[model samples]
Target: AQSVTQLDSHVSVSEGTPVLLRCNYSSSYSPSLFWYVQHPNKGLQLLLKYTSAATLVKGINGFEAEFKKSETSFHLTKPSAHMSDAAEYFCVVRGTSGGYQKVTFGTGTKLQVIP
Candidate 1:
């Protein structure tokens, strides 16, 4: 089993600047990691995943994240901020626990778009 932490409870960015959202994870084994976003009153949508394939994983809406095993981090980044990007983002870690698979989600980071 593994756990994840979303460093910031809320992050604010202007319309066009770079956006950085931090996340850290703990796992006994190589974990299957994923990032998901939830818009206001909307269901969660899968952003990207690290399935032991690529360190740099890209998602929809110009979002991407890098998996750093050495640091136990999987921080999400965007080149530019967008008004539509305002949402609650979650970092999820999935692994086996007690011989059964389990999933854990980080405390969500709420992205606020400012003018």
Candidate 2:
């Protein structure tokens, strides 16, 4: 079984500042992890993913994350926050459930950008 936990339910950042969203996860074996972002009244967008190939993965909109096996953590970060970055983010984990693969999403982190 695999699961993901988002450490923060909400994150507020000033425009032009840095952004950070924390997450941790567990899996029975090597798993596929992903981060997805959603704007208000919009569809989910893929941010980044780690499939056990590279540790540091880059994504769109100047966001990136590192997959640390020892820490069981996958944290998302952006050097500078943009006003458009305000949204809700989900940390997802892919694992096996019974005989089928399952994808689990965290509670989500709502990012509020303060002008």
Candidate 3:
């Protein structure tokens, strides 16, 4: 069975502070991991992806994640959080067996920004 657990359901930070959203995954095979950010009523934007490539992957908006096979973790991090960064984030894993790529999203982590 494949599953993912987000360490936090909600994260609140003031503008300019560091941000960390933790995630751990379990898979039967080599998994493709992704992090997506969605603004209210907007579509998901891919932040980063890990597909047997570099262990440390950087994405847009100064966000990055390190794929740790041993730890079975792919935690998203940013040096600083912006006010615009307030949104919902979902950790996703692509399914292997299905013909169409089925992306399973984590429950979600809502980011709250304080002025």
> What's the TM for model 1?
0.98
In the range 35-71, model 1's lDDT, one tens digit per residue, is: 9999999999999999778899988999999999999
**Candidate 3, 1-115: lDDT as tens digits:** 6788888999999888999998998877788999999999999999999978699999999999999999999999998899999999999887665545556788889999888
Error of 2 at 96 (Å): 1.5
lDDT tens per residue, model 2, 62-112: 999999999999999999999999999999999887989999999999999
Q: Which candidate comes out best when scored by TM-score? A: 1
List the candidates' TM-scores in order. Answer: 0.98, 0.97, 0.92
> lDDT of each prediction vs. the true structure?
0.95, 0.95, 0.89
Alpha-carbon deviation at 28 in model 2, angstroms = 0.7
Query: In candidate 1, where is summed lDDT lowest over 10 consecutive residues?
Result: 50-59
Q: What is the lDDT of residue 82 in candidate 2?
A: 95
Report how far off residue 96 is in candidate 1 (Å). 0.5
